[model samples]
Target: MPRFAANLSMMFTEVPFMERFAAAAQAGFQAVEFLFPYDYPPATIREQLDKYGLTLALFNTSPGEVNAGEWGRSVLPGREQEAREDIDLALEYALALGCEQVHVMAGVVPQDADPEACRATFISNLRYAAERFAPHGKRVLVEALSPGVKPGYLFASQYQALAIVDEVDRANVFLQLDTFHAQKVDGNLSHLIREYAGRYVHVQVASLPDRNEPDDGEINYPWLFQLFDAVGYRGWIGCEYHPRTTTAAGLGWLAAWR
Candidate 1:
């Protein structure tokens, strides 16, 4: 069976943020992930993980001013310093929490922004993050966001994310293949797994359109899970989805899978 990580940010919202760790463990999850860990002290998060014996799968670099509609800032031109700072901060937290990977979120691009400039900035910042994380036995990951859902997001396709990872030219920098975004932008899910599994170090999933639990999505996750095993990807597949009902109630799909 594939190893799965519960996304605390999206999966266990029924409880308080700090309390989700135990909930995930009680749900029989051996690993967990979330969007950002900056809200609480690193030691506090670590306590939850130690208490539950759950591995930290992945979390994103700090997204600047999320309330201002900023999904990420790394890809925005002139924000390289801020992006680098975000990397350092994430590294600090990751070290303290024993997490081995961090996702570099590509912030939304303005309509008038130059695509080339954004790409260059993202590539440069990614290289910086990868270099900084490599010494600690950690990795930097980049993901392709679905275009319509997060308008103006820099990486809207797997190809784009792959190209950026290639350009970054760091062995520790890997693509975060978010299946929900892949289903939205690239439909050949099996072929994608076969061809690009080597490029990914982490994976996330949610049903398309609604971003719900994996069972009812257009993409058949069981087949994808088998394909992932066939392709030799032994990494954690994160359950990053919004619950249709209470978080615990919505976990029937995962329970059935288990």
Candidate 2:
């Protein structure tokens, strides 16, 4: 079966962080992932995962206001040191929670940042993360942010992911293609799936325009699920969408999704 995870970052906002972990477990998701577990303690997160028996699929390194100020601006060339240091902090959490991937957010391009240099920094930072986490059996997957998520984000296309993947060229390094983002930036979701399936380390979904449940989207998720089946993408599909209703009310999706 294709596993599922609740992206606690977007799905359980009304609950406390620890309660969100509990909620996801109660909802029957075997794993969970989130962005920036900065507001929570590592030991607490570790204990919650254990108590709930949920795997930590992914979590991000510290992001300095990328949601406001350059969201994820960590991969600029000059920011390599910062990126490494941030990942080091994340390492403690990753180890504690048994996290599998970290989103090395390549923030919006700096005014004077050379594109190549920024991309190089992104690759270097990924290499550092891969090396840092390999011994712990963890891999750092790069989540390419859509322009909507970060207006001037570095990677907005699978093509860009390919370019970076080619440059980085490491077994542990891979790409994450979110359906909403892909639909926003690239029209051919099925094509991207067929073409870059090998590059995909993770997958997420949401309705277009509204970023709601998959059932609310115009993207033909039934066919979308078929596409995943065709591609043999036997992996956990992360529910990383913003809820259209109260988080608990959004539980209606469970019946449909199940």
Candidate 3:
């Protein structure tokens, strides 16, 4: 069976962030992931992980100026310095928390931005991040955000993300496939799983259209879980979804997997 990680960012919103660690452990999750951990000290987050005996699966670098509509600086030209700073900060947190993977966000493209320039900037920034994290035994991840949810984002297709990984050409850099985004952009998910089985380093899941629990989605998650096992995908599958009702109430989908 595939190991599932509770995404604290989208799951368990009934309690505060810190308390969600215990909630996840109580719910029988062995690992957890979140969007960003810059709001709290790394040591504090580590304490909760140790207390609950949970492994920190993954997290992303800070999205620069979220309110200003900036998802990241890596894909924005002339922001190489800021991107490096973001990478360094994320490395600090990953080492402190004992995490093995970090997602490097590709910022949204400006209305007047050149697509080629943005792609080049993204490749360069990813190469830099990979080099930096390689020495510490860490991996760098790049994800494709759906254009509908994040309009003008760098890329929305898994092919685009895979191409970026190829261009970066670094062993440490890999794709982070989110099923929700993949289903939104490209619907043949089964083909994607089989075709890119060993290419991606992490996987995230949620229902299509509603972005709810995986149990009722158009995607057959139970079969996908079996496929993941067959393909030798030994990585954490993040539960990055909003519940139909309460988080705890909607977790019946996880019981069979547990």
Instruction: Give per-model TM-scores.
Output: 0.97, 0.93, 0.99
- Model 1 per-residue lDDT tens digits across residues 75-128: 889888898899899999999999999998889887889988988988889888
**Candidate 3 least-lDDT 10 residues:** 215-224
**Total backbone collisions, model 3:** 0
Q: Which model, 2 or 3, shows the larger lDDT?
A: 3
Q: Which ranking of candidates, highest TM-score first? A: 3, 1, 2
Q: Per-residue alpha-carbon lDDT of model 3 for 1-258, expressed as tens digits?
A: 899999999999999999999999999999999999999999999999999999999999989998999999999999999999999999999999999999999999988999899999989999999999999999999999998889999999999999999999999998899999999998888889989988998999999889999998588899989998998999999999998999999989888988
Candidate 2, 146-247: lDDT as tens digits: 776777677888778777877777777778878888888878888998988878878888888898877775798767887887888976788888888776
**Where in model 1 is the C-alpha error above 4 Å?**
none
As for candidate 3, its clashing pairs are none
- TM for candidate 2 is 0.93
RMSD, each candidate, Å?
1.2, 1.8, 0.7
After TM-score superposition, the amount by which residue 23's alpha carbon in candidate 3 deviates from its true location, in angstroms, is 0.5
Model 1 TM? 0.97
Clashing pairs for predicted structure model 1, backbone only: 72-107
Model 2, which residues run further than 4 Å from truth? 65-68
Going through the candidates in the order shown, the clash numbers are 1, 3, 0
lDDT of each: 0.90, 0.79, 0.94
